[model samples]
Target chain A: MDMIKIIKPGLLTTIQDNGRIGFQRYGIPVAGAMDDFAFRVANILVGNDEHEAVLEATFMGPIIEIGFDGFIAITGANMSPKLNEKNIHMWRSIEVHKGDQLSLSGAIEGLRTYIAFGGGIGVPEIMKSKSTYVRGSLGGYNGRKLMEGDEIPIDASKSKAKVGRYISPGYIPRYNNNNVVRVVLGPQDDHFSPEAIETFLNSEYKITAEADRMGYRLEGPKLTHVKGPDIISDGIVSGSVQVPGHGSPIVMMADRQTTGGYTKIATVISPDLPIMAQMGPGDTVRFKKVSVEESQNILFEYEEIISNIKYRVENSFIIQETDKLYNITIKKL
Target chain B: MYEKARFLPAGDKSLIIEFGDSISPEINKKIRDMYLAIEKSGLDGIIEMVPTYRSILVSYNPLNIIYEDLCHKLRELEDNLNDSGSEPAKVVEIPTIYGGDYGPDIEFVAQHNDLSVNEVIEIHSSRDYLIYMLGFTPGFPYLGGMSEKIETPRLKTPRTKIPAGSVGIAGKQTGIYPIDSPGGWQLIGRTPVKLFDPFAEPPVLLNPGDYVRFVPIDEKEYKYILKQVEENKFTVNIALLDK
Candidate 1:
């Protein structure tokens, strides 16, 4: 059984996939990759299924010692990945031999980074997902963040040893401190005064230090509500924008609770959720309103691009046999 | 007669069907009724449906079905919704031991209401509480129908950690904590029955729309049930109640 031994578990690293879905009815949250785009690309680059479990590292990353010959890809927040003390570019799959050391530094741009291996992280699926819901202590690597010296098992059943897969630079999203995410006014938007909704979209809200996988509490201009802040507790989704009595908005993310009592003003669109997740504390964000129809169109476009990437990664691309620039040949079956 | 349900789109992936704005049995029943309808609709792209106090969160795949089509299908289901879920809901009796170490806040709850601890326990355990929804933590039931006589304000300072199966009263509500987590509800008693066992087949003991009846037990009975629960031999006394 091949595995990656964590020599140094940096910051908050955990195994995550597309999340524990279809469980919100039981008051279970859908905890998945905060940045879904980077997670999928890393898996595609490493020749794994799009939803394969990968190492999601926040701020910094782990110092892992490979125990077998395989391939790995890094994406999302650039954590300055280094293989054997040499710098390695992200969004590309690299082949490695046993005993090779791979390390990553603190984030240079985005808040979280994902590391995908040819074989997915081999954690038993509790509730149909390998994604970690730390608050609930369920799923993924003993249901918590990776600790030092913890040898994470890699499911080699789906391992593909080939490498040299890279995503086009144009396709890789460049994360920045200032972001504008699109949102759709919600189930409880009527609870807020017209002036409050205006303030919410016009004002720039900075992510407070209270940001985590569960949700991000933003500090901005107070949002006035027409009705009281509280609602009969109801189901919560990943991108639901809830406004409590305090007037500040809280953006529910991957590890958000299954239900909440606060009135939700709006919900961030699916296409721009990756951007919302990548925004770190101290980062400022502004909202752009979009219709549900337009938002679904954006989602279709994004899905189409990923489908194209998956096709290319599985069929196209010439892998270089060696370090020489001229050793390119078509990928062999 | 109930008002027409409002269909609100929750982002791109979910749609919220709000039956009403109040927390009552009628609203909960409406939400649960719609939940059953959507579940049996064979509606494409609906990943799952969450029935809350007054709304149902329908999580769907945007790629499979568009928002307008999904809404149209849901409206159709609502128009043709059946009242079949009213076929005698189960009443799960949770055996509890009130006061002493098991219930640290029992005294406070009694003092706040100016009633004897025994009276408080009697009032709390006398009636059936409706399970509105499960949320906050896994299997934590949002119960309704607590008597105003035992109503008490929540702790000014919430406990950092509350043990699982602790029956509590917050305001005009009484419920149980399914898992060990942070909460501020006033603990009136503790139950030996496990409300939530992640390793169990269903994970959670109570289901939405079920009636919860707390049965006050003695220390000896509590210890007996505790041992049985630890050995996984204890079964919650559930019986169908005719409305």
Candidate 2:
């Protein structure tokens, strides 16, 4: 029964998990952490399930005071972090003593940051998720952002683990400001003018100020659709780059609506979604079109490597340690 | 006889079954029929199925069902949709306000159509709008039934944000913005009622295949209805019709 009290809630911080599923039918969007890769990595660093509850901070993070000793890890954007006025490195697990105050400044680079607890941040799950959908006022921290004087409870089971284990830089996700997202042709890509499609692939688009978790409205060359081809409304997915009447493309992201009527010229591949999530306004993005098969192969290879690494780490935990220094001679006897 | 349907790839995880290029009751019925038949067939790995005016978008887990197989299953189900169209539909009435801040574009609509605001409201309120399909947002009904006399183009340089409950007319169609979202539809009026309430058992006020009627109310009545909704004292009336 330990808790963390928020002394200063920076910019926009909210408790999130993988997001609320099974409620899309209700018109409720699946609102969760903007960067799932970083969110999951922070959880994995502390031996917690990748989808366990965690804190999703915007460009700026919170100043928190731990009420009890615990292990924590920070991931995603490189926000300078200090614990009790001592500088701490990002992407590594650290032990916190009770009464220690942790402060995170504005992100020096990147747009989002994930904070994960060893046992997971304790929050009631609504519709099977702790992610907050602020529009509907559903899920997470009373369906709102974390504020000053807010005290969030931590799962007591997490306190039993031995603290002070540090994560190395290798575990950290590197954020690239100039991102080139890989994409595949959408269903309605044929509806767009051939020249427009070619221009889309060849040009570099700048992320405009009109951006949010729902989608990023890009400002670039006008992408015109074929004269007689108007797309009807249909289901939309994250990473779908839709072109509205204005001729600008909006790349739908995590909090995007489930459906739309705009013609989608391209969809970002699943593997490159993490890189896109880290991008902020004014960032330039180039879209590289790849075949569906190639995109799937990339995703498959990434998953295989992740699983293999997890297998090695989980196996290490089960192996017994030997006291080799005490006995120089063979112990076959 | 209807035209042959085409299957297009929606994304890495979905497929769009296009009935045709145009909107007609025939195509709309086919889309709904196909959706119902596929849903009842219990196609494995089909996570969610959405129907629009002319196409049905089926979303499935790529890990569970391959793209080719999902379409094959859909084709198998499409053959059985001829008999499902006889099912009944649920019709709903939605009360709304048609002038003032709720509907700043009311006068504009009147001016564009060469009719008075009262006549415009009368024409809009009298017709039964068909729910083509829900899209753009959750529980947001894309209705089809506005007379050409009252139809108006969307606002130029669209508002950055339109509050939820703002009723709008865009081109030939009209829909209520169930959530406070950025949009370009010309606002005709607003409603105090919640078009979508997540806390309710069925969150969306109107479902696909349901008919909707807009009843104009005065400002005093709008405030009264708003309070009634907050206090859970409002009851929505409906007229069931055979498909």
Candidate 3:
């Protein structure tokens, strides 16, 4: 089995997949990659399934030593990845030979970055996922972050295609310090005053330093509530913008609890979640209200684009294979 | 009397069906009834249904089933909820040890209530509490039905870490910590039963709509039960509640 030894385990690196589904009824959180877009793209670049487990590095990136020949792709944030002290490109697959060293530094743009291998990480799946839930101490690499001197097992299966596959330039996501995120109002919009709702949509909020995989606590205008912010405890979904008595909004994330008591004023759409996840503590964010239909339409459009890209990549690979066969035939003649 | 149910959109992919405005047994029954009805409907693309105090959250995949179609199906199912054949609540007896080292805040609880430690224990153990939901942490039950006499405010500052199985009271709520986590509730006792075990099939000992009763035990019994639990020999006392 191929393995990668961690020489320096950056800030917080953990293995994550799409998420743990159908376990929230048991109070288990659906922990997965914070930036799902980057995770899927990285896997696709390396010829792996979209739901394959990848290493998610927060803020900083790890230095890994490859023990076997394989392909790897790094996506999401530009962490200035280097192969044997040489600069490498993001959004593309790179081949690694035995004893090659891959290192990455601090992020240049976004918060989290994803590193994916050709055959995914070989971690044992608990509850049908490899996503790490660090709080529960279950799933993914003994339920903990990667540390120095840790050996990460990589699946030995390799893609037959040559490495260096890259995503289209149009498909690459761009991040900025200021992001405008769209939301759909209310499971509990009635709890807040109309003025409060206006304030939530109009005002600018700064992501607090307490942001993590669980939730992002935003500091902004105080949203006054007509009634108390408390509600009968109910289920909370990812991107649910909850407001407590303090009036600031908390955007719940992948590792949020199964339920909460605070009133949720709005929920960020799935398509906009990657932008929200890429935001750092000092980043400024503004919310724009959209209807439920608009949110669903945006999701549909995003999925359509992803499928188109997949189709193009498959067609191009087939063309390259035919070219190679024609060259061999001409040489034989 | 049947209360009118309101369908509120939680997100693009999920909806919340609220039974009523307050937390009560009647509201909880409706929530459970709706959950069972939806489950039996065999609705495709339904991800999971979470039953809380007065609401049931139905999450689904938008790609598989649109929101309007799902809402229509759920409304049709709600009309037949009375005939959904909901299961009866399960009564779970938890073996607990009050005061001493296990419950560090027992003295404070007794003084706050102006009662002796034994009186506090008796009042707490006498009534069966209903499990409204499980959240905040894995298997941590949010229970209702603590008498007003034992009502205590949460700690001014939450402890950095509270041991699992510590029975606590915060306002009118009493619950057990399913895992070692930071909590603010005033601890009054400790239970030997494991509320959460990942190795178990269900992972949680109590479910929403279940009833729990605390059975007071001595320190010796606590140790014995703890040993039995460690060896997987202790079984939680469970019985079907009368409808």
Best by TM-score: 1
Chain B TM, cand. 1: 0.96
Predictions ranked by TM-score, top down?
1, 3, 2
| Angstrom error at residue B231, model 1 | 1.8
Error of 3 at A218 (Å): 1.8
lDDT-best of 1 and 3 = 1
Give the runs in model 2 whose Cα sits over 4 Å from its true position: A25-27, A87-93, A123-128, A134-138, A157-172, A193-195, A219-224, A228-230, A245-248, A317-333, B1-4, B96-121, B153-170, B179-192, B215-228
In model 3 chain B, where is the ten-residue run with the lowest total lDDT?
Answer: B1-10
Q: What share of the true interface contacts does each candidate keep?
A: 0.76, 0.33, 0.57
Report the C-alpha lDDT of model 2 over B1-243, residue by residue, as the tens digit. Answer: 245677777556667788987777778778777777877778777877667778776767666776777777777777656853557766787789998889999899999999999998999898788888776676788888789998899888899889999998999888899888889998988988888776676667887766888888998989999999899899787888534
lDDT by residue for model 1 (B15-56), tens: 898888788888877777777777766888889888888888
Docking quality of model 1: it rates as: medium
DockQ of 1: 0.80
Better candidate by TM-score, 1 or 3: 1
TM-score, candidate number 2: 0.83
The residue pairs that clash in candidate 3, if any, are none
- Model 2 agreement with the true structure over A1-333: per-residue lDDT tens digits: 688999999998889898866656545677788886778767766678878888888888899998777778888887898999999866656777789998999998898888887788788877678988776567888888889999999874664333333333464567777878888887788878789999999898999998888899998998988853346667677788999888889998878776777888888876777788888899999999887657666767766655654443333322124733121221334
Name the regions of candidate 1 deviating beyond 4 angstroms: A321-333
